[model samples]
Target: MTDDTPAGRSPSRRTLLKAGLGAAALPFASPAVHAAARDVKISMQRSSVLFTVLKVKGTLAERLAPLGFTPTWHLFTSVIEPMNAGAVDIHADVADAVPIFTQSARAPLTFFARERGSPAAEAIIVPADSPIRTVGDLKGRTVGVSRGSGSHYVLAAALKRAGLSFDDIRPAYLQAPEGAAAFEQGSLDAWSIWDPFLAFAEAKRPVRAIANGTGLTSYHRYYLVNDSFVAAHPKVVATVYQALVEAGQWVKANPEAAVALLTPVWGDLPPAVVAAANARRTYQVEPVERAQLGEQQAIADTFLEAKLIPRRIDATDVRIWTPPAVKG
Candidate 1:
C-alpha cells in the first residue's frame, strides 16, 4: 500500500482535540503526586519499529514530554538482551518476547500496548545464490537469531510449519547487527531479523526472502512493563499508548513521510528501503485479542518444548490491559 501522506501536514485541530480528550481520560497524576512517586525508566531496541515512536523530536516524544514524563532510552543491540538484564521499567519489542520472560520464573510483566500490524518490520532472508528456496531448505542448516525475541519466535514457528524443529538446524544466537555482519560474511546460512536491520542487510546483500513472520507468527508488537509501574501510574501508561497509537495512524496514512522521519532517525537509510519497510506495517496500538494470545502462547509452549525456557508459563497473565478498556 502506498501512502502519499504529505509531510508538514498536521491532522486537523479537531482530531488533535479529540486525542487530547482521550489523553485527559488517562490516569495522569499531578507533579506533586509524581514527585512522591518512584521514577521509572524505559528501554527500547534501536532498530525495532517501536523506535519510530521514540525517535528524537519524533511525534511520540513531543506528545509525552509535555506530560511531565521523562523517558530514558537505552539502545540495545537486540530485544532479549535488554529484557534479560532487568535494566528498564518496560521493554518494547515483539509481544512474544513477554512470554519467554514469564515462563522463566521472572515476574509476569503487564502488556501495555500492541502494534496493529506485524513489522513489515521483520523477516527471514537468505542469499540469492543459496540453494534454499523455501522454509524446508533450512533443514540441518544454521539459522541466526537473537534468542528470546520475536525474531526468535518467528523462526521457531517457521520451522514447525516446515516440519522441522530447533534441533533440525543449528541456532547461532547473535544480536541483529552481528547477525547482519555474519550474513554478509557468508558465515551465517539464513538470518531472521526485524527491519531497519533486515532492510539494511537486504540492501547490501542479494537475498531472497524465505518467509516473513506475517503468516507464521503473530506480528503484534507489545510493551512489557513491571507490575509496579502499571499499578502506580496508569495515567502515564495510557498517555504513552495514545501517543503511540496516534503516531501509528500517521505512519499508516503517510508512508513517504514516515520514511522521511526515519531517514534521519535511522541515519541515512535509502528512502526506498525505509518506504518499503514502512509500507508493510500497520502502526495502530491496541490490546491483543484472544486468538492472538493463543498463537503466542503456543510459541511459549514451543520454547518449553525446545528447552529454551525453564518451564511452561500460562501466558495469559502477561496481559495487563483488558480488551474492553482498549475499545475507544
Candidate 2:
C-alpha cells in the first residue's frame, strides 16, 4: 500500500480505506447492488492502473455491495499476469493484448465494454521544451514502452505511420511508471504511456504529447471475461456493464469530483491532469466494432513483424462477442 499522493508519491490503499470508510459516505443506491444480492461474487483489481478506476471510485463496490455481493480487491503489479493465471475472473484491459492472447489461446477472451472515441488517453510524450516536435522526429531517438502492452502497440503504430521502423528508434522496455520517471528525469527522449500516468507526467514534468490515439488508431480499453463467465451468468455481466456505463458517464460529467474520488486510489495525483485525461477520454460501454477488429489485426501483424508474438493469428477467431443490447 503506497501513499495516496499522485505526484509519483505514495498513497497506500490502506490509507484510502481508512479515510473513505471513516467518512462513511456511501455513493450508490441499493438496487444497483441488490440486482445480484445473492448470486454473484464481484471484485476488481485494486492497483493504480487506469482500468481499476472503478474500484478507486469505490462506486463499483458501492454499486454491487448492497446487492449482497461483496467486492474483494485483488492488487497486482502487472494486469496480464492476473488475467493469464485466472486469479481474477474478469480483466479490464486494452484491446492490444487481445491480439496476443487470442493468437496464443483457444476460444479467446471476449470484450464486454469499450471506451469509444477516447483520443489522447494514450500517447508518446516528451518535454514541452524538447525539440522533438512531431512523430517524424522520433526516429533514432530513445522511445520507452512496456514490452507487451497497449503502449507498445501505440509506439509501433505511430512509428509505422511515420514511415519509420522499430529499427529506426532506440526502444526502451519499461513499465508505465518507470518510463514516465525516466522521461521526466531526461534520461529518455520519449515515453509511450496510458493515463493517468500519462496525465501525471504531463503535469509534474515538462512533457507534451507528440501524438496520441489520433492519426494512428483508436486504442480501446476493454472488459474481458472467460467464455465460461459469459456462459454461466450473462445477466451478471450485463449488470456490471450497466454499472460501468453509469460510472463512465458520471466521470465524464463530473471530472473534478471524479478526480477527487480517485485521488484516494491514485495517491492524490494532480487533479487538472486527471481532468484533462478524462475529458480526452470517451468512457462508453459499446460493443467491439468491425474497425476495432481490423485495427487489432493490424496490431497482430505488426507484432509479428516486430517478432513480439510467436506467430501470426486471425484476430476474429478468438473473439466472443454479444450484441449491443446484451451490454449496458
**Top candidate when judged by lDDT against the true structure:** 1
Q: List the residue pairs that clash in candidate 1.
A: 27-235, 121-195
lDDT of 2 by residue, 54-162 (tens): 6555555665554456454444335564455555555644545444654454533566667665557778988888999988998889998877777787888888888
Winning model by TM-score: 2
- Candidate 2 CA-lDDT value: 0.63
**Candidate 1 versus the native: TM-score?**
0.79
Lowest lDDT block of 10, candidate 2: 21-30
Q: What are the root-mean-square deviations of the candidates from the true structure over C-alphas?
A: 9.3, 5.5
Runs with alpha carbons beyond 4 Å of true place in candidate 2: 1-7, 12-68, 95-99, 102-108, 289-292, 323-328
